[model samples]
Target: MTKPLIIGVSGASGLIYAVHALKYLLAADYTIELVASRATYMVWQAEENIRMPAEPDQQELFWRDKAGVKTSGILNCHRWGDAGDNIASGSFRTLGMVIIPCSMSTVGKIAAGLSSDLLERAADVQIKEGKPLVVVPRETPFSLIHLRNLTTLAEAGVKIVPAIPAWYHHPKTIEDLVDFVVARALDTLDIDCIPLERWKSS
Candidate 1:
């Protein structure tokens, strides 16, 4: 069986990026191991007006019934709440991991090697295992601290994909902008899903 891709959603403003990533990955028929921080749920509710249940089972039900039911591919989702989950260990192989809309705090914690939760621990495992680790941070007017921390992660082989959308595609909708960032994240993972128009020479 192909190893699953781990998707970690932290508390960030752009929850739609995470949503788009999940949808595209499912369409690509990649098994997903998903984990979201409590703050992520809160941000989702505040920004997207969607409430994600805290329990792992209920979270899966919510995604299956509401968020991802339309897709034909198997979700193959396994949700985990604790940091001690198997994916947190380097022994558990994965296709790699992406933290969509990664919060500044999440970036800092992961950069400092502080694995207080499953999201952080899983990312730590990815970095230590020499696997692909993409972090999509969604912050504006970044401070030096944020830049330094991000630089640290980059030096350690982490792909820092900020949630900055480009207008060269002449995006017509919010979803287009969201997909631009998601496409970049997918590209980092070597996932073959193009949700946006690639820049071409005129």
Candidate 2:
């Protein structure tokens, strides 16, 4: 059986990053274990005006429609406060974990090995298992404390993929720019499911 990847969506400005990442991952038939923090829904509503259902079943359906995945791949949506989720254990055996739009608080908690919830617990599992852990942080004007927290994560073998898009992609629309960051985030996990314009020197 193919190992699934754990995707933890935290409260951040770029909710679409996780959306686009899911589209590609599903298209590639990669099964995913997904969990969204409480603040993620708040940011989702503020940024996209869409209310993410808190119920597990409804949330899975909501994600299905969002990613346009009718029946391609498996997406197991775990509840936010469920600390007993399977992904929380290293024995669960996963490909790795990616926290798209990871909040600074999540970063700090994971960096400090503090698993206050299932999301943080899952991420900590990845770190302890020495598996791929990619974090797509969305923050601007990083304070020294933020930088220190990020650096601490990086030093612990976490791939710190900031939510910065490249102009070299010559993006013409918001989706294009969003895809660039999502593509780079997947690149850290060596996943090439989604296509993007790679940089070519002039």
Candidate 3:
């Protein structure tokens, strides 16, 4: 059986990135092991006007509905509530992991080897196991402290991808922008899913 790809959603503003990425990954038929931080639920309600249920089953239903993925597609997903889940261990092999909209606080925690939650612990496992770990931070006007922490992660072999969309694609809508970032993340994971148009010099 193909190992699943771990997708962690941290507390960040760009919940759409995670939603779109989930859809694309499911469409590509990759089994997903998903975990969301508590803050992710709050931000999803505030930013996307979508409320996620606290229960794992309800949260799975919520994600499937929001991503417009069919029931079978969602069947390929395995949801975990706590950081101590199986994926948090280095022994659990996976294709890789991506933490979309990774909050700066989460970044700092991962950088310092602090696995306070499943998201952070899973990321830590990826790093220690020498697997592809892509972190997409959706913050603007990064402070020096943020830069330093990001650099630390980079030095430790983490792919720090910020959610900065390029206008070169001439994005006409918000979804386009979200696709740009998600596409970059897929690229980093060595996944062949392209959610947006690639830049080609004319």
Candidate 4:
């Protein structure tokens, strides 16, 4: 049986990162377990001016259309408030978890073990289970508080994958930049969904 990987989308600004992540993962035929916070919906509206479907099942279709995926990747969308979901438990047996465009609030909550919702709870499960937890934080101009919270997670074996794109790759298009960061995030989990090339200095 192919183990699914958990993908958490918080209320972060860079929703595109999460979208690109889904595109890559789905194209690679990897099963995904996705949970997006209610804040994610709000952010999607404010950022993209499009209202994401509130229903989990509807959201699954929304993502599929966005990815334009022809591959057979399975996606299981969970409600943001569903704490009883199996992904919230360690026994659920996932490959690990990745929170793309991770919000500072989610980072702090997970760092303090204060899970108010499904996204946070699933992240907590990864920590307790000793499974890989990768967070691609998108906020900039980090204050001390944000740094401290991120540092706390890093100390606890979480991979703090930044959303910064590499210029060495000489990216010319916006998709190039997005894919570069997505590549970094999945690589942290050993997924290699994007599989960007390694840098070679001249």
Candidate 1 total steric clashes: 0
Ranking by lDDT: 4, 2, 3, 1
lDDT of 3 by residue, 95-133 (tens): 899999899999999999998777888999999999999
> Global lDDT for candidate 1?
0.84
Please give the range of 10 consecutive residues that has the lowest summed lDDT in model 1.
71-80
Q: Give model 1's TM-score versus the native structure.
A: 0.92
TM-score of 3: 0.93
lDDT of 4 by residue, 15-118 (tens): 88888899988888889999998799899889989898978889899888877774469999999999999999989999899999899999999999999999
lDDT, model 3, position 32 = 83
Stretches of candidate 4 exceeding 4 Å from the true structure: none
RMSD of each: 1.8, 1.1, 1.8, 1.1
lDDT of 1 by residue, 62-110 (tens): 6655546465455533343577788889999899999988999999999
After aligning candidate 3 to the native by TM-score, how far in Å is the CA of 62 from where it should be?
0.8
What is the TM-score of each predicted model, taking all chains together?
Answer: 0.92, 0.96, 0.93, 0.97
Give one clash count per candidate, in the order shown: 0, 0, 1, 0
- What lDDT is reached at residue 192 by model 4? 76
